[model samples]
Target: MSEVITGGCLCGAVRYRCTAAPNNVGLCQCERCQRQSGSAFLMATVFARDAVEFERGELKVFAAFDDDGQGLYRHFCPTCGSAVMITLDRYPEIRSIMGGTLDDKSWLKPTYSLWTSSGQPWLVLPPGIRLHPDYPDGAVA
Candidate 1:
């Protein structure tokens, strides 16, 4: 079992706790991730949906579709505009937390890259790290 990880949004409008370790922590090079994160890619940490819980405010969700046109929920704090969490329809059992929103991002690092083939030009991922042409193995657990 992984240690419990706790974090909240920029303005504390959204708070969350995870009782188990993330199944995956990685960068997403998909176009939607780039656009939503406003960066080269989105740094995300995946956990079981059942392992996460909100302590206070609720997240406002904006549903997005992946390249395959599948639903992906982008969750954020309506009051702070901070990107907090996500849930992909393609991988229903997983919940991904935006790593940047963590109080201490020092411990969070991508173990791999997702959607590398769709990655933006000029975005160079770390050498030798696993790059999933699509979703990585065990992303939903």
Candidate 2:
């Protein structure tokens, strides 16, 4: 069996577990991601939708649409307002966990970065990782 991954919100109001390994892990520097994260970028760990289970608390969802009219749902802890997860209409089968929320982050190694066009001018990307101005061909945002 795959090792389970666990994480939660800042106030401990929300917790979750992933039953399988992540499908992908990447950084997003899109304007929406930067604004939502209050940072230069958002590190997202992608997993199969069915693999994630909310173990405690409830998440308040904020839904927004992309320029293409696709849905982008941001799920956060209401108590602490910590962005915990994201779901996209463009990739219905995946759930993206906020990498900063992971209880154990020592294992994370992002392989690519998306929306580099919007990335901060002073921020230097990791060495040798794939970089995309937008979403990679057929990959999640």
Candidate 3:
């Protein structure tokens, strides 16, 4: 088994653990993500839903559709308002942990990026990473 990945909200109000190895680390630069994250983009590390465990606190969720008209849900800590994870319609079995909330983000390296067309022009994406104009088919592993 891979080493566990753990994280939480900024205020320590919420925490989570991932038993499975995290893969498909990437960013979403869509308008909704930008607005919700209050940042240039949303960085995330993907894992299977069953592999993740909510170790503490309940998350408040906001449901919406992505720019591609796919169902999306954002889970965040109600107290600190820090986004913890997201569920995408394309891969209901997968859950994405917010990169910023990870306790050990030093090892975080995004290998692909979603919604490249909607990405900020000023932000330069690294070369060699897979760039998808929109959601890639079967994006989750």
Estimate TM-scores for all models.
Answer: 0.85, 0.95, 0.91
Tens digits of per-residue lDDT, candidate 1, 1-141, equal 237788899898788888887787888888788888888888888888898888989888999674789888899899988889888878888899988876667677677888888887887767766888877665541
Candidate 1 least-lDDT 10 residues: 132-141
The lDDT of each candidate is: 0.82, 0.93, 0.85
Order of candidate numbers by TM-score, starting with the best: 2, 3, 1
Expressed as tens digits, the lDDT of each residue in 1-141 for candidate 3 is 338888899999898898988767998887778898998789988988898898889999999975689878899999999999998787888999998998888888888888878878898888988888877887761
Best by TM-score: 2
Which window of 10 residues has the lowest lDDT sum in candidate 2?
A: 1-10
Instruction: Give the lDDT ranking, best first.
Output: 2, 3, 1
Candidate 3: residue 85 lDDT (0-100): 93
Cα-based lDDT at residue 119, candidate 3: 78
lDDT of 2 by residue, 20-106 (tens): 999888999999999999999999999999999999999999999978999999999999999999999999999999999999998
**Candidate 3: clashing residue pairs, number:** 0
- Greater lDDT among 1 and 3 belongs to 3
RMSD of each: 2.6, 1.5, 2.2
On lDDT, the candidate that comes out on top is 2
